[model samples]
Target: MRGYKQPTVSVIGASGYSGAELTKILARHPSVKLDKLYAFSQAGKKTTDLYPWLAVDMTYEAYDGEFDSDICFLTLPHGEALKLVPDLRNAGKMVIDLSGDFRLKNAEEHLRFYGREKPDDACMTYAMPELFHEEIRNATAVSNPGCYATSIILGLAPLILKPQDSAKVNTVCCSGISGISGAGKTAKTELSFSEMNDNIRAYKVARHQHTPEILQTLGTSATEPSFGFTFTPMIAPLTRGIYTILNIALDKHLPVSEITELYRSFYISAPFVRVREMPPEILHVAHTNFCDIHVAESGKDGSVVVITAIDNLVKGAAGQAVQNMNIMLGYDEALGLT
Candidate 1:
């Protein structure tokens, strides 16, 4: 390790679940030096106060407009990250945002869904390493995909990548069952342990903020294909992970075995995506960065069902951000992730 140099990194929203997970992952990252831990409200608190399990002894600093790190991660909320990312990029800092602010390319769509004006000069690449590996590698700013979007998009990518008739493709419906952690660390009366126990409920029916994100990715991932999708996000009793069922209707039918092979081939070079024989379960991917996917053919028509499971906090947010960081820094994609 002699004569080796490492980039300095910082986490802006270090108190939140995604931020804390990013902090933990960066702490173990061999290539970067975690230099600052900033939080808006929990500024003076130690990381152990928020996450008792982490071995780090760093105290959170109040997020003043001062940061001198080589790379910065904004794990803040949707509307919050917009205000900071542009400035960070201007100041010559590589920024990876784990928010929906930069995911939507259209400013009007961002306002329509997130109920806020998009950032003035937001130019960033959407970071889904398995799909946008080249873009993320060359970009200074990266927008991490949403949890539900990550699960559903990876499940459908194989089908979308192929040539198909736009008219023949039917509706794509996805139902995602997520653990309570997807709601974030904020305390809500409905998200309480007493209320959340033994309960399954859908919150954002047809208007989840992540809906457009999935649509946008699907629209571009395929060539000359018009496929619309409906995403319903539900909350389960557990504390981590997401399970998504994607029902895709197409004009052409491929056997289940062929579909599985297609998916496996699509992710052949991806270090974190796994193709499974049986449907993926949340427990298998709980603390890891892996997204487990299963493909099956159903109905007499040309319908293929894809089931995917991933840790919402990991592959969906923090881990993917770090993976992008690795790519941007020219390190092995699975360097610290494994």
Candidate 2:
């Protein structure tokens, strides 16, 4: 960041889980100054009121159609960013959106998965730093990948990006279990302690919104992948972290060592992804920006399973958004995150 001025930043929807996490990170960032925090519901309250541990002395204000910073992070719900992103970009403010609003390239797919109609020009650079680093560096607006999509896409990217002809993918079936915080700050009966404490259940089976995001990213890397893909998202009892298990059927058997080496090589330059020799647990990655991945043979011929763990609010949302901001500003990709 030599010879570069500290960029001013603002966070909209700072009361939500992801937004608070982003605020915490930006408060201590060395190269940027957090200029404002906006939360419609939490407006008029100090950040310390909600997060007593945060050292920043700033009040949450309502966004008044004015962005006075060089960059803005939108942690609003789906369809909400659609209303703000266009104007922000037109005003020359770099934007990073942590919702499903601008991730899908195809408007029909966005409508089918997110249940909202997308405008013709609503798409942004899909911000998976490891996969699309250069594109994000030049993008004025970036769409952060969903929590589930982060784990599943990073787990499957190495194989999909450089597929071996002998090991053509036949099917991809994944199941993700995330902590309660991923549900946001809203209160729900099903997400209560009594309901989720000693229980876990799948909600969106095959029609999960992240399914299309996973398929879309993988398809972009390789020839339109024709393999069958299914995703089941579940909510577990905890505060943070997302664990994904992927069972992939290939045309030929691939040794675990070979797969491990491939993943290691793929994420060789990726600062936040760790290729593990043993399976990763959710607790190990809790509260961190690292995504731990382990690949193994499933004891059946031509079958391999990849396990990935990440903090849904960190690597999946806020931390990854900061990583994109670093790249877009020509700073080190892992500048403030490490």
Candidate 3:
């Protein structure tokens, strides 16, 4: 991240959903020199053998050896960061952590939800570029936001930038089909075809860990994260994407024209978020790094509803992680990520 050279990047957990996605993007980047891919569980195996689409390239080695890339993407699970970042950062490699570990600020707060172990004292900066691009621009350690939290928080983040004359949002988001793949490329009873095909049940209820993350990112403790959500998640048969719908209550009556102005003003410089009048569809952003958002309101009660859609594995995970990497390296920010 310190030099002007094309970055040498590496992906850990190379066989997982986000890991493979990161490998694909980096392998083609004109400025990113993809060094290696690592999957401890599938160590000593060819990545093409696992994710057949890769087809084994000579220019890059997949899971063949340990690496010393300029930038490292940790696509591991929550607690896994506690084990990897210290070693990588000590070796002077910039790190973009895609798990939940570094996103929360305090060690005790992090350990409370992610079990008893804590990550090393990391000076981690939030990596949702639209909100923290200034901070990410010079950070050595970055923490990407969760899928639900990214869509939910960013969908309504525009309202927070200004004094909401009285915008009170009551959000009820039904996360789309692809989140199960996010669960892991593993075998689970709930993820089985038999149980998931036509069945949908809400797991994690009121205690979903992402709940606090959404609140913390979007509102102040004094302002109150009174967002009550009916967050029902289903295992859809689709392979990728997350769509969130937030039903909001505005503090005062505001016109749609005014809302559009506010949204555009808030995200004019953000290249990935598209704020629209019509509802955002999953297909519009299925394979890209875009978060398409839409807003609607009821005049009678001053209520507004926001819809946000993103490819969970891309904008919600690897793509956004790379976006953070670009910022941290002082690159064009959108380099290699259109």
Taking all chains together, the TM-score of candidate 3 against the true structure is: 0.90
Q: List the residue pairs that clash in candidate 3.
A: 166-251, 167-251, 177-236
RMSD of each: 2.7, 2.0, 2.9
Distance from true location, Cα of 192 in model 2, Å = 1.3
By TM-score: ranked, best first: 2, 1, 3
**Runs in model 2 lying further than 4 Å from the true structure:** 1-4, 220-225, 298-300
Best lDDT among the predictions, by candidate number: 2
Q: Which window of ten consecutive residues has the lowest lDDT sum in model 2?
A: 219-228
TM-score of each: 0.94, 0.96, 0.90
Give me the displacement of residue 8 in model 3, in angstroms.
Answer: 0.9
Q: Write the per-residue lDDT of candidate 2 for residues 1-338, one digit (tens) a residue.
A: 42348889999999889999999999999999999999998899999899998888899999999998988999998889999988898898889999999988778778877888988677889999999999998888899999999999999998888757657778888999999999999989988888888899999788788887888898841114478787889998879999999999887888899889989999999999999989999988887889999996654478999999999999999999999999999899888887
| lDDT of each candidate versus the true structure | 0.85, 0.89, 0.75
- Those runs of model 3 whose alpha carbons end farther than 4 Å from true positions after fitting are 55-67, 107-109, 119-123, 165-178, 221-230
Candidate 3's residue-wise lDDT over 258-297, tens digit each?
Answer: 8778888899999998988798888999879999988766
Higher-lDDT candidate of 1 and 3? 1
Clashes of each: 0, 0, 3
